[model samples]
Target: MSNIIGFNNAIFWTDDTEILYCEFSNTDPNAKLESTKAKLYIKAITTLCKGKAMPFVIDLTETCGTFTTSVAKFIVRNSELKKLRISESFIIGTTGVKLLITLYKKFYDPATPFRIFADQNLAQAYSLETKQKYHNSIKKVVEDYK
Candidate 1:
């Protein structure tokens, strides 16, 4: 596993098993994850995927940031992003975020498969399984934080 990218409160990378992972920091309780930060995340995912479909795992455990309805819509509306992802996405977070994810799924009905997990290990295992099922590989190009 290698750290390929880092933002203010998040780190993005492809693990040894080839699952794309985005882990948000838990220290900042007041941080708000707005549309701009969402865009940056999209950019990072696009760069990492490089037009290939891969399983994505988001670790939101202990993060205080909240996503607005508009931010969720922004992610769903990103056509380019839609093309580069596998059918499933796994998110790890608290109960509140899990509820939010439920609402998002109900409202958005995203084309991709999305699941929420309270356990990070379970999420990672699922992601790796998905990658293997689809025969995807870890991205070869790794970029340092800019």
Candidate 2:
């Protein structure tokens, strides 16, 4: 079982050793993400990571509900998340305008890798597999790619 760490009315946020996992809250599928609540969610992530770079596995199911501009900014552009050190991110259930809107909100930070997936399990597995690929390789390349 996952350790219960924080609260969300319509989103499920779980903490693990390798990544931050988020999905729609089964308890409140109809819940909407208010702009006011975005801060709480963003802060929770930075607090949990505590400066360690980690991958994010996000399920955007509930996000299809009424997500506002402020909420999008909070999720994708908050300067506070710099401390969270997001190594990479994996998203599920986003397409069309929603995906484009989200893509627009995220400012390109070349260091951060972003990917989309259809399956949470695949995203999770890849997140773990690619953990070291982003967080560990700091030294300059002494050799060309094989």
Per-model TM-score, in order, reads 0.77, 0.66
Q: State the weakest 10-residue window (summed lDDT) of model 1.
A: 137-146
Please provide, for model 2 over 2-100, each residue's C-alpha lDDT reduced to its tens digit, 9 standing for 90 to 100: 533456443434555658776644334345567667777776776666667677776664455445556655666667676554544445454642464
Worst 10 residues of 2 by lDDT: 137-146
Cα lDDT listed for each candidate: 0.73, 0.59
Summed over model 1, clashes come to 1
Question: Candidate 1, overall lDDT?
Answer: 0.73
Highest lDDT model number: 1
Clashes of each: 1, 0
Candidate 2 achieves a global lDDT of 0.59
What's the distance in Å from true for residue 39, model 1?
Answer: 1.5
Candidate 1 lDDT tens digits, 38-129? 99989988887767777888877757656677887888889977776664454655677677667777787556776788777888777777
User: Which pairs clash in the backbone of model 2?
Assistant: none
